[model samples]
Target: MSELTCFKAYDIRGKLGTELDTSIAYRIGCAYAQVINPTKVVVGEDVRATSNEIKNAFAQGLMDMGVDVLDIGLCGTEEIYFATKFLGISGGAMITASHNPIDYNGLKLVREDSKPVSNDTGLLDIKLSAEKNDFTFADVKGTMSVVDTTKEYIEHLIGYVAIDTLKPMRIVVNGGNGAAAPTLDRLEVAFKQKNIPIEFIKMNHEPDSTFPNGIPNPLLHEQQAVTGDQVKAHKADLGIAWDGDFDRCFLWDSDGRFIEGYYIVGLLAEAFLLKNPGASIIHDPRLLWNTIDIVEQNGGKAIQSQTGHAYIKEIMRKEDAVYGGEMSAHHYFKDFAYCDSGMIPWLLVVDLLSRRSTDLQTLVSKRMTAYPSPGEINRKVADADVAIVAVRAKFEADSIAIDTTDGVSLSFEQWRFNLRKSNTEPVVRLNLETRGDAVLMQAKTDEILAILDAHA
Candidate 1:
């Protein structure tokens, strides 16, 4: 058996046909069943053109191992997580490449109760078993069944916000030709059924596997313009966009100004703390000061964890945190079995907007001005470690505090920045925040880039 390159640190991903194909996906399914040895498993797929073929092949492999498969067709990654926990299933897998390009695909796996399977957990074992490609068949093959959890999932989402309290606000939603369109449609119908007067100005609101408007990654500046334009053209109250699998959602204010994910973290922390004061909120180390201030000001505890969904979820469960957020737009909720959701964050934000009777700009602008951040900037270098070490060495003498939690974080009296290597890509990411000094932020960002450039 040949080695498979699709296995990654947290999940399985690779270019289609070359690095991954139906055969490899089948082997992975068989290997997962062999390693976990579960009686039943759930499966889901995104809107990619090849997803159905890959998912069907994987399910066949599981069935050959006597593992009954509950096929939840055409859904996001979080849906699989929800079904795994809600249905009392032993395991689940979602076939998606997330924000990756059109030519790529992968699988995100979880065990019982929707617990993630990272490299340190069960992914490596699954990879090794798949590489061996030798498995014993069960006495009897298991059966396959189809199930739809759309209504239940929508109901669960509506539970987050009071229907009557939602004002008749016009909001723009850009699905970007991904899986979010279907889910958004379902939510819209549910709101109407409940007599909610919210109006949805839909844009690119269809599941086109071809990605006619390009991929749904709103993180890129180019991909953000369409949503911003729509928001402005419709003169909507707010704007929201999602990735291909709809696991992460981005926001725009009433003026069509993009809100950095860092501020959204602070906003969400405040929202949760309003209801449950003294609760714990988990955040990543990349961008800290804003989140720390918001969490502390609300009489809540702020805990910093390493980046990545697996780490955040684990820390949230341990600390019993009400919420956890990453600057990269991933948000986790304790009520959602410690798993991250794209749907829940937007729902909670809309609720906050309605309850406050304030526009999105007013809700977050103060926090943004108090703690200005350059969001996350990325630089490609020959060696990320060398660049990180150089930055730490140069700043250690003047830094008030230094932390190596996930990367190198140096804090001074007024400002701080974190330099870390991207886990899934070959680049170094930098995040800097200052105490109401945009000039100082830009100057320091330039200095750090010079150091990184020297290494490059």
Candidate 2:
């Protein structure tokens, strides 16, 4: 028995072979069964080359412990979240690297009701058990069943929008050869059957385990141009891209400009508030000015939680929030068991555009001007905590206010910024936005960069 490095801050993720392998996966399965003690659990795998092999090992480990496994093969992380709650299972797990490099892979686990088992909640206990690697087979081993929930999942997604109100529009979706291609195909069929006037122009839409077109991350500056160019080339109203597991989706406007997720958070917060007035909307501490402003203006309450899916979901359930959003493009819905979904965000955006009869750029241009942010800027530092402390010391004296929710957020008269260390990586991230001054936002961003560069 030995410690496992695959266990991370919120999930199981590590480089293959050295840090993680089939044996570690099996140990994790055993640990999950021992800790959760569920009669039945849902398991899923993404399109990564080794995902299925690792998933099988994990499932067998569970079966050995007398825990039945429902295997949803070749699916995104959100599918595991959905199946856990939808099937009323005891737990759920997914095998995916999720925008990590091709050589890397990992697992995401949740207990009953699709609640995330993160570090503080239950991951540490699970890690300790897995490291023990002491297990005895049950008198009667459990069974494994192959399941497909694509159609049902699609139905649930479509229910978010009224088919009758959909206007004719063209959308460019760059799947990046990940897990979303099949779901996109199914959604196309559903829309056609319902006579919805929407056309999808897909780019790199097939599930290529090799990821020939790169890892499909729209957040990368270099990758952003790929989707934007396609949007312009196809003259599509919107461009959408997803990571390896499709848990987060990024968007670009008709003018081929990538809209930061911060603005989309505001847009979705307003969208949900339009339907459910006086609802509480959950947002992360990083880049929340836009979200809070929008939520307050729409008769909604914007509550800030520490960043990360587990914390966001916990606060969402605590406050009974209708929606939660992170500037990193993760959007959660109260209706979806308080789980985040990449598919849902784009759906709601499309529906909002159709009903409002406005173009994508026009819909968000005002917010973009009102609060201009450069999205998240991550810098590798020798020590994350030291870097944050140094930056805080340099700016705190001049700051009007300070917040330490997930990271250090300092407020000024016209602009504010958040500096935090990443939970999963050895990097310090910075996010800043201005009330209405884009130039000040840029200048301050540069100033912060200089400080970080010197201190970090």
Provide TM-scores for the models: 0.98, 0.98
Worst 10 residues of 1 by lDDT: 418-427
- Give the Å shift of residue 47 in candidate 2: 0.8
For residues 1-456, what per-residue lDDT tens digits would candidate 1 score against the true structure? Answer: 778889988999999999889999999989999998988999999999999989988898899999999999999999998999899999999999988999999999999999999888799999999999999888899899998887788889899887888877888998888888888888889888999887889988888989998888999898788889889999998999999998899999989899999999998999999999999999999997989999999999999999999999999999999999999999999988899999999888898988998889997899888889888999988889888889898898999998999888999998999999977666899999999998999999999999998887
Candidate 2: minimum summed lDDT over ten consecutive residues — where?
447-456
Global lDDT scores for all candidate models: 0.91, 0.91
- RMSD after CA superposition, every candidate: 1.0, 1.2
- Give candidate 2 regions above 4 Å deviation: 424-426
How do the residues 1-456 of candidate 2 rate in per-residue lDDT, one tens digit apiece?
Answer: 667888888898899998889988998888889888989999988898899989999998899999999998888889999989998889999999898899999999999999999888789988998898888778889999998888889999999997899899899998999999989999999999999898999999999999999987888889999899999999999999999889999999998999999899999999999999999999998888888988999999989998889999999999999999998999999999999999999999999998898988998999989888888898888788888888888899999989998789999989999999877677999999999998998898998888778765
Clashing pairs in 2: none
> Against the correct fold, how does model 1 do in TM-score?
0.98
